[model samples]
Target: GPKVLQIPSHQIIDMGQMVTLNCDPVSNHLYFYWYKQILGQQMEFLVNFYNGKVMEKSKLFKDQFSVERPDGSYFTLKIQPTALEDSAVYFCASSVAGLSNERLFFGHGTKLSVL
Candidate 1:
């Protein structure tokens, strides 16, 4: 099954720094999503984008976090001034449409280590 692929596999950064994670999804995927998980914790949705706009974002998406696919290519998630609490595995996902029940193909995830 085709799935998303995240770049840099892992990232280590200092607090107050900025990091951008890139996600390469399948060619036909239309909806893009970002999720965050801290080690053993359950994954939480951060945001979803479609039609060149943000369809929804969770409280976890702070002011420092943003997402976009400028060239309709790889979807990207950027976080600036990252906090120590921001250390987590960020997963990128995609699906064909907005159907809630549709299964999303997820990337391996970018493990962010904030120090």
Candidate 2:
């Protein structure tokens, strides 16, 4: 079975600092996605990436957030100048296929806190 792994299950940071969350996606999977959920809100899509380029990004992906795959390694999400509003559970998901109908496997999530 395939799985996605997220590191530093919890992160506490200052409001103006930078944070880079790590995600190890299932091997051989080509599509990766990032999603965020506030304490009581529904999960919102942030961005999707494939073939070394961004496939789609929602408005929720602010200028401070970025995603990348360096040397086919684990997918990563970096947020600079973190804000209090950025506190949320960030999830990393991967799918074998890039189709909308494909099933995604999600990591437990990295809970981020900004103070």
Candidate 3:
């Protein structure tokens, strides 16, 4: 079975700092996506990337957030100048295709806290 793993189950950071969350997606998958869920809110799509460029990004993907593969290694999401509102459970997901893709497999999530 395919699986995605996220490191640092919990992270606490001060405001205005940079944070990079790591994700190890299923080996055979190509498309990668990031989603964020604030406390008691529905999960929202942030961005999707494939073939070295962003395929789609939602309004939630603010200017401070970026995603990259960087040599087929772990998928990473970096947030620079973090804000209080950035605190949420970040989930990493991957799929085989974009349009016809089925349900995404998500990691447990990395809980981030910004103060």
Candidate 4:
């Protein structure tokens, strides 16, 4: 199966620091997405990017969180000044659609613990 690969399954960071999560998706896929999930809570949409621009961003997307796909490569999320509430499992996903039509393929997820 062609699934997204999230590097470094777990991260422990201090409050008010920075961390980056990496995702490797299907080589030909164009759209990239990130979802955040906390224990006992439903997954919350974070951000979606396409064609080198951010298509949408949820309220959960904090100012400290940054996303990029440099050189059309890996989809990455960088969270600086991580807060305790930011400790959650981030699932990386990809779809082959532009706006109205899309199907998500989700990865296992990378768990981040901000202490």
Candidate 5:
């Protein structure tokens, strides 16, 4: 598995506030992804990014959420006017290939607390 590092292990924000989670994925990986997991629940896919574009996103990825990796910098997931339901542990992952055949490497995850 590749190594993925996510900054700010824990984030606490008020409801309707905005937040951005940063991930430093494997340098050579071609695909990046975000997943959300609530306590005692399974991890749910949010979105995947490749070649500076968003390739796919699940319904869980609300309109307020955006992702980007400017100039090959940190892969980021930003949420504006976040809701209380948005609170969860966000996992960042990367792989050499697409979601189907590649082995994904995941970060520990950034826990978000929206009050």
Candidate 6:
């Protein structure tokens, strides 16, 4: 797997606050995704992006959550007025093509702790 870097390895925020998780995806990779893993739970897909649009997102992607990559900068996931349920480890992944190719590379993950 390619090495993807996630900034601020850990984050602690209170309920109803906002938090942004940043990912420096693989430079050559185009498609990007975000997955969440609660402690002791399975990793669940949240959203995927390509070009400049969100290709797909799971039901877990709440209305308060948004994803964007402006001017080819870092791919970011923003959660506003986050709930305690949002506390999880967010993993960023990227692939040159789509997930069908099975070439996804993942970051170490940003641990978000919502109190």
- What TM-score does structure 3 among the candidates reach? 0.95
Q: Which stretches of candidate 6 lie over 4 Å from their true place?
A: none
Tens-digit lDDT track of model 5 for 22-57? 999999998999999999999999999999999999
Task: Write down the worst ten-residue block by lDDT for model 4.
Answer: 95-104
* Candidate 4 lDDT by residue in tens digits, 2-110: 7889988998889999999999977778899999999989999999998888889999998999999999778999998899999999999998775566678888899
Better of 1 and 4 by TM-score: 1
lDDT of each: 0.94, 0.95, 0.93, 0.90, 0.95, 0.95
Where model 3 places Cα greater than 4 Å from the true spot, the runs are none
Q: In angstroms, how far off is 114's CA in candidate 6?
A: 0.6
lDDT tens digits, residue span 4-115, model 6: 9999899999999999999999999899999999999999999999999999999999999999999999999999989999999999999998858467899999999999
TM-score between model 1 and native? 0.96
Clashing pairs in 3: none
Q: Cα deviation in Å at residue 85, candidate 1?
A: 0.7
Candidate 2 local lDDT, residue 3: 81
Cα misplacement distance, residue 28 of candidate 3 (Å): 0.6
Q: Write the per-residue lDDT of candidate 2 for residues 1-115, one digit (tens) a residue.
A: 7889999899999999999999999998999999999999999999999988899999999999999999999799999989999999999999987887889999999999999
- Determine the backbone clash count of candidate 4: 1
lDDT value, residue 79 of candidate 4: 98
lDDT of 1 by residue, 1-115 (tens): 8968899899999999999999998889899999999999999999999988999999999999999998888899999989999999999999999697989999999999999
Query: In angstroms, what RMSD does candidate 1 have relative to the true structure?
Result: 0.9
What TM-score, computed on C-alpha atoms, does each candidate reach?
0.96, 0.97, 0.95, 0.94, 0.96, 0.96
Candidate 5 pairs with clashing backbones: none
Q: Kindly report which residue stretches of model 2 are placed more than 4 angstroms away from their true locations once superposed.
A: none
Model 3: per-residue lDDT, tens digit, 6-115? 98889999999999999998887789999999999999999999987888999999999999999999899999989999999999998877557377878999999999
lDDT of 5: 0.95
